[model samples]
Target: MRSVFLALLVAFFATGVAAHVARSNSLRDEKLTFNPTNVHVKRLAHTPRTLTNAQRLARGLNPARPQLRSSRRLAGRGGPSLTPTTTSTSTDTPTGTDTTTSTDTPTSTDTATSTDTPTTTSTDTTTSTDTATSTSPTPTPTCTAHTGVLELTGGSYNGYVSSETNSFGEYSVTTDASEALQVQYQECDGAVSYGPINFKTLNGLSTYPYLGGIVGFSSSSDNLASNSPNYVYLGGTQESAAGAPPQRGANSFSAASGTAKDYESAIWSVDPTTGAFTAHWVNTDGTSSAPTIMVVQDAIVLTDDTFRFIQTYGDAVIVSLTFAESSSAAVPPQATSSA
Candidate 1:
């Protein structure tokens, strides 16, 4: 019985050992099948694959053992090689168009020096004869009682205070007739400044023609000498004329500005018979003085009763005469009457 049991145990041990050995051999076969070195391919020859005909022609070299380009060619530093085996030939010739270049130099010189400084001198010079002046005494007009008279009220800016008449039978005047014919200047606040008076004669009758002209003074042969109308100019201003209150009675001569002084008056007349013209400039200050500086002109008569009477203040034409007989006359009369 002991020998039988020992034999059975030995058989079991041998079978177990054989099973373990078979599992070990299977694991070793799997490890060998998955070896990483199996994928490595070792080169046997030095040459690469055969080159195509186009590749060989493009490289200009034999297909067998073709030479590689140098590093300079790879870096685009070398020009194309002109080998004998190359079928294509090329040559480069530089070309350019004609060019022109030009330069200009300018030379100029401009110099200015202040030889004399500009001056703001008054145009109203003492030697200026624009206004009538007296070198001798002037004879004053004799005072006479008249009927036909025109009184032109002249004050500051308030209002006119005078009478209007076409004949000497209307009123009477002595030496203050010039004051009664006073007129406020067009400027100076529209007569806000007290202006001087004026004296005028129309036909043979007494007439006060201030801003406008008179009519019926025309006669035959009035325009025989010339077509331009006869004109009379009176220039000057009263210093109290501007910015002065209305003071109507003060006539005679007063303080004035510009070239026009006190009693500076002029008269221009045209003969109705001969068509002749004359001017008389007087300093109405009752002086028997010869007009040394008379800026007068001899003009021909224009239309019948049509004339230009110019009154200047400073350098401006403040008033002009007009005739109602002519259409071309400027600033025609406000009213007209017969002589």
Candidate 2:
């Protein structure tokens, strides 16, 4: 029985030893199979299984490897190289030059002089003498007296003719037995040449009294040659009072002088051809009244009955008539007459 028990104990020990040894071998085999470096090298060197066309066709996948480009070929084609390139440059400087020159010169000269002189001379003389003679006196001047006659065949008028009828011409103011007052220019031939101009028809003359006298006169120096006189002068009193008898008067060289009334007076100029007349002047200025008309030399003179000068009308009042002197042989003096 003791032997059997010891045998059983030894068998138990041997089974434990075997079990440990088997466990150690399993560990060693696992370590050898699972080594990291050897496993990596083996994976690197090991060829992977590839799919065939038939196998790829069966799995619906491409069988060939994908063609990929290189990095440079992917960047661009025929472009500039990425490597940097360098360049070298050079410069040159020039030189300079300068030149100068100058010169100057001057000269001058002057001269001057002056002089003066003068001289004079004079003379004078005197003498005396006397002389005398006798002379005669101057003589007095004389002029020839001229004489002629003025005749009138007409009769009984309201005015007068000059007392000296022998003059070359005569003038009178009268009415020709009509209401119209007439200025008669009587020639030496006993013919009336110019007038009997009706003073009643003239303006301003119509209201006056009967004209006292009329004279045909001119400014011309030659009287007896021309028949047409320049103007005829009429002189008379103012309007007569209501009861006065027409202030009638008549005078002649013969003994037929009649009495009349004279008062305020006026003067008029008359045209012989057309019987037109204008009142040239008036004498109602009462300082001197009663103007009797007459021609003396070359002017018409207004006077009192005594033949004293009252007023001279103008040089234009000279009597001019168409007539022959009574004695043609007698040289006429400056032709004077009166009324």
TM-score of each: 0.15, 0.15
Q: Tens digit of lDDT per residue, candidate 1, span 265-316?
A: 2233323233222323222232221111111221111121122221211111
Mind giving the per-residue lDDT tens digits that candidate 2 earns over 22-61? 9998775454321112211110111123435553322222
Kindly report which residue stretches of model 2 are placed more than 4 angstroms away from their true locations once superposed: 1-201, 213-339
Question: What does candidate 1 score on TM?
Answer: 0.15
**Cα distance off (Å), candidate 2, residue 127:** 99
Worst 10 residues of 2 by lDDT: 39-48
Global Cα lDDT for candidate 2: 0.28
Residue 108 of candidate 2: its Cα lDDT?
17
Backbone clashes counted, model 2? 4
